[model samples]
Target: MFTKILVALDRSPMGKQVFEQALALAKATGASLMLLHVLSAEEEGSPYAPLLTNFDYYPGVGSQSFEHYQKQWDNFKNEGIQLLQSLSAQANTAGVNAEFTQQLGSPGRLICQLATTWGADLIIMGRRGRSGLKELFLGSVSNYVLHHAPCSVHVISVPSQVTQAEEAPQETASVN
Candidate 1:
């Protein structure tokens, strides 16, 4: 019954699964898909300013550094653009009407805003399955979206084995 489905892509290992699920849902429901990827300022550094504050540099060196950061920012955004384009192509190839947006902001806030702006009836995304103190400390975009999204949210949880493999510490055998 969903006419517009928004998929929030985080580019995590779980991304492929999330896209596949969203694509399938859209196909089954004959819904158009909107793929959204947010490039967080904290993750990519601020785009409008150099991160190195309180520093003095030789003539032209400051400009060079700022240019370097700007190049990095462009590359970061380009990567997101390429990813969204690729995902959109996949959906289009599967006969689903799909469009994408790559924005810079808080992921949760951006996703909710886009969902409202796009009139999405359903949102599908992958959850890292963080809980307890780890989730509290790291914060959870999925959790925030679930609470604040304008539409229904479907969170595909990461598998336990995947979580364990990523988070579990290596063990060493004791010498007798």
Candidate 2:
């Protein structure tokens, strides 16, 4: 029933899965799909902020919070743009009308905002993301989107890597 769909993705397998799923849905509905990725200031860097708060997590956590995350944030933005491009190509090959947007900000907040700005009818995303336990404590982007999405939101739970690993043994046994 959806005509406009938005999918958020990063450089993770789960993100890939989410995009694939969205593309399939778009194809079935003859809908348009948007691939959006947002880079957090903390994940990228706030070089333009009036005042810089040092970031010292990964390498420079001891600095202030801004210095350390700037480079990382930049990398995240650039990498995410590349990924969105690749996803757009795949969607095109699938004969699905797809466009992409790479923005900067908090992932959850930005995702929800795009849904409104793009007038998306539906949002499809992974329930658990790459953030791991930190996401659990901070609440996941999916969680936030689920609660705040304008129209409708579908939070699909992707099977974890650990489960895929464990399933290998079962897969081979089942094959024989």
Candidate 3:
């Protein structure tokens, strides 16, 4: 019954899974799909950014200025745009009406904002399956959206292997 379905994806392997779910839902409901990818400011400006990239730092290299960080952020957004373009192409080839967007900000907040602004009837996203204390400490994006989203949220969780691993201890304890 959804007219507008918004799917939030990342470059992670789980992105394909999330897109598949979104495409199926759109196909079944004849809904238009909006694919979104958000790059967190914290991630772009993190101290470990250099380590994450191929950039090598010399011991006496100049410190990173504001302009440097700004340029890096721009590059990150460009990469995200490219990824979204590829995904959008796939969706289009599948005969699904799909448009994609790339935004920079907190993933949870941006997702909710876009969902509300775009009047999305449903939001499909992938979660890494973090739970318990780890979730509490790390802050689950899906959890945030579930509580705050304006519409129904469908979370395509991580693969069963990860979920099962996370639940192993609980499953063992329950049997005792």
Candidate 4:
């Protein structure tokens, strides 16, 4: 029975799309839903290492120094809680039993860990997420969850907005 389901989300187009699909499925199935978002750890190594190793950034010259942002640590954690709260509220309105979880570390790993902790019988997520290249290089969250999660995994593939627009018919050559 898919009584427990976990929906992974993040601040990415694919993440949002998967969340929407999961929500709908949760409603239809009368399944309890949980939302999980993971924050990456602070690597002592060069921050650019991740970008350089994974992303499609231009090698040397394209890299630029970032103006370091000093943000409140507690506030940063609270922001994650707030996102979970907001997501939970949406589920609440839909009459789904729901909760939220936030953890720090590799996203894919955290997602799998939370699925275990939450005792979710099913997990639904986007095929690609915020960290495309990094995930591609080190397995996407969905991919990891598919192999590692204790439950069944659902990967939702969504077409990009540009693809949708391109598929739409041309407005018109009006014949007056």
Candidate 5:
């Protein structure tokens, strides 16, 4: 009996699965979708701003380095926007009303805040299997959202094997 569904997406492959599940649920429940992508340096493909050390505390290491970092950050934001637009399009094509927003902040906090502000009835997201020390150190966004979200949360757990495969670097075949 959900009226509004918020789908939190990242750049990972699991993001596609999360969107698909949300779309299916929205279609079935006749709920509108709010696709959200949170931009953070911690996310893959996002560039970290150059740190100012005691040795050189002007602005960054150099203006060139800062400029490069800025370019990468812009690209990361643009990519996130593109992804949200793509997902929204797919949902619309499936006859599900969909809208998207790309914001900069902690994923877990943003998801919960948006869910509350948007009045979402449910939040659907994917969780990369993280546990023990890793979970403690890095923190689990899904875990935080589940406990803090104003609405019900459905987490799609990505298998450990799948997560490992996605993390591994791809090999290219050399043409002889």
Candidate 6:
């Protein structure tokens, strides 16, 4: 009974699973999809800071380090846009109406805000399965959304094994 579905996505592999599940649900229920990507420094793999050793102060805007960091941030934002576009295209090709947006902010708050503003009937997102001390320190976006969202929230838990596999470095095969 969902008319509008909001799908929160990230760069992680689990994000694709979340989108696929949301797309299927939208197709089944004839619901429009809103694909959202929130850019935050807290996000895993974010290039929000430069790798400076023993740095005491923020890099000046005119400094080379700052310029390099800025370029990395810009590239990150562009990648997020490209991701959303690809997902939206996939949804459209599947005969589901879809729109996408990328915003820079706290993920949990932005997700709930968008859901409320868009009047989404449901929110579909992925959980990294963080727990205990890790969850306490890092904060879980799905957990926050589940408690604070204006609409029903469906959380897809990303298996720990899958996460580990994704993080592991790929080995190159030697051609004999």
Report how far off residue 28 is in candidate 1 (Å).
Answer: 0.7
Give a tens-digit lDDT track for model 2, residues 29-140: 9989999877654332334343344333346345545655567657666777888988899899999889999886788899989999999999988765435566656667
Per-residue C-alpha lDDT of model 4 across residues 10-129, encoded as one tens digit per residue: 656666687788888888888998898776543111122243232235554342322221233345566667878988998899898888887777867777887887788888887643
Report each candidate's C-alpha RMSD, comma-separated, in the order given: 3.3, 6.7, 6.3, 7.6, 4.4, 4.9
Candidate 4 displacement at residue 78 in angstroms: 3.8
Query: Which candidate achieves the best lDDT against the true structure?
Result: 6
Local accuracy of candidate 6 as per-residue lDDT tens digits, 1-176? 99999999999888989999999999999999999999998777789874444343545434676668778889999999999999999999999999999998899999999999999999999998776787899998998999999999999997787766666687789998
Cα displacement (angstroms), candidate 6, residue 91, comes to 0.7
Score candidate 2 by lDDT. 0.76
The TM-score obtained by model 5 is 0.87
Model 4: ten consecutive residues of lowest lDDT: 43-52
In model 1, the Cα lDDT at residue 97 comes to 99
Question: How displaced is residue 7 in candidate 4, in Å?
Answer: 1.0
lDDT of 3 by residue, 118-167 (tens): 99999999888777897887788888899999999999877778788767
* Clash counts for the predictions, in order: 0, 14, 0, 0, 0, 0
Lowest lDDT sum, 10 consecutive residues, model 2, at 42-51
- Model 6: residues >4 Å from true position, as ranges? 50-62, 163-176
Clashes of 4: 0
lDDT (Cα, tens digit) per residue for candidate 5, span 76-151: 8899999999989999999999999999889999999999999999999999887778789989999999999999
Model 1: how far is 34 from its true place, Å? 0.3
Q: Give the number of colliding residue pairs in candidate 1.
A: 0
Regions of model 3 farther than 4 Å from truth: 41-72, 163-176
Error of 4 at 37 (Å): 0.4
lDDT tens string, model 1, 1-176? 99999998866778789999999999999999999988885342336454456335445557668768779879888888898999999999999999999887788899999999999999998888787897888689998999999999999998898888788897789999
